[model samples]
Target: MSEPSTYPQPPRRGFVLAVVAAVVLAADVLTKIAVVASLEGEAPVRLLGGAVYLQLVRNPGAAFSMATGMTWVLSLIALSVVVAIIWMAPKLRSIGWAIGLGLVLAGALGNLSDRIFRSPGPMRGHVVDFVSVFAPNGDFFPVFNVADSAIVCGGALIVLLALLGKDYDGRSTKEKAKAGSSEAPAS
Candidate 1:
């Protein structure tokens, strides 16, 4: 009889991940474009009794407006994140991990695309940001957009899954090892 193959097959999770990433990127880009077109050179639009507001802003930095005036450095970091996600996607067997990473990837790519192609020079373009929350003290939260939201959510999910002891494929690593051992042929 022919020997049985031991190599594992590629998981379908990667395809799902890619699709989710694409959707997120598309949504982020579309929303940014809409915000820019609607609120260009306009004042902030108050919403939710001033607890929330829609204001257009351009960020030339990372999250929470950090590293201002370092657009190239931020662009490099974003590009690196996207590359890492793409490289890791195929190896992820867990749907949860794939989903989380996909979201992160999409968000990174969305902002990186803006940095590469938007106004100003390459890798020095500003990211379009909107959606702000206000405190009772009249200070506004840093403006952010869908891409930032996805990135944050994805990062949170990754932490959650790790804390739950789930592997990249959503199975506990111990469980997977036990299952594999059980399936092995006796010598």
Candidate 2:
């Protein structure tokens, strides 16, 4: 009797990754809603003895507020990311890949939600940014939101995984060869 092959394959399910994406998206959306509600008319609320501040601002542009009048283009880009992630979800096997891609999905969907449902118009709305990390002169860093943070972290993780020679299928070359040899019929 022959044993089952040990070769890696596309996972039958990616619910873990989906859950991660859901959590991040929920956090991003909920935080943005809360910040908009609480910090609408109030001054910047400092926390951690001034290390962090919650200052509500609307960004109608890309990172660092660049391309200030091109929000629709940015929304399209985010939508593409969302579509790509959904297409790639079925093949996710490695935990690291799942986490990375999940964060990316979350970030994309989170901001896309804002673009679709927030003020101004559909696909032309501003993203709500409330968290400002550090400021030596009060204007050094770009104010960012949870979705942006997730995207950055997820991208970094993907880069790190690549540098470590990890693949999405979770199988090294040697394992593939062994699995292939084991599946062959003997003379």
Candidate 3:
């Protein structure tokens, strides 16, 4: 009987990535719709004893209300992120990366959709930010939405992976170094 190769193919991960992205996108979109419908003109809904607040905020800017005048630029950046994630999906081999990228993809897509289709015009629309922390109307923490949260979490995960030398190809920096050293010709 033939022995198995030392390296096995990476398990199917694209599906997991796609599913995560789809679920997050759906959730963010649905929640935004619900909030817009119910809290458009109503007062902020305090939850968990003022720890969280929900209201309607059409923010034409980046997270924390930054760059309020660059909605169109933000839209393009988000669109680019979406395209980059989609391009990288087929190459994803690590489950961690899959989830991380999935979250990022969903975030970019969610906000991109809003910036493209929401009020104002195409590529210049405001993002639907309806969640605030500490106080209503972003008194403490800027009002943000699901997309912003996902982006932060996912980006952090990706950065952590990089710092830990974990590659999306399921190899570590040490492993790559060892392989390279072993493959070198004797002097």
For all candidates in order, the CA lDDT equals 0.84, 0.83, 0.89
Write the residue-wise lDDT of candidate 3 on 1-187 in tens digits.
2333366768757888899899999999999999989998999999999999999999999988899989888988888898888888888888988899999999999999998999898988899999999899999999999888889988999999999998887777787787777777778
**lDDT (10s digit) by residue, model 2, range 1-187:** 4577655465633686799899999999899989998999888888888788888888888878898888888998998998888887787788888899899889989888888888898988888988886652237588889999999999999899877777666755566667678778998
- For each candidate in turn, the TM-score is 0.84, 0.85, 0.93
Which candidate model has the greater TM-score, 1 or 3?
3
Model 1, C-alpha of 42: deviation from truth (Å): 0.8
What would the per-residue lDDT of candidate 1 be over residues 5-76, giving only the tens digit for each residue?
A: 354644757887898899999999999989999998887888889887887888888888899889999999
Residue 151 displacement in candidate 1 (angstroms): 0.4
User: What does candidate 1 score on TM?
Assistant: 0.84
lDDT of 2 at 21: 96
The all-Cα superposition gives candidate 3 an RMSD in Å to the true structure of: 2.9
Residue-level error in angstroms, candidate 1, position 59: 0.4
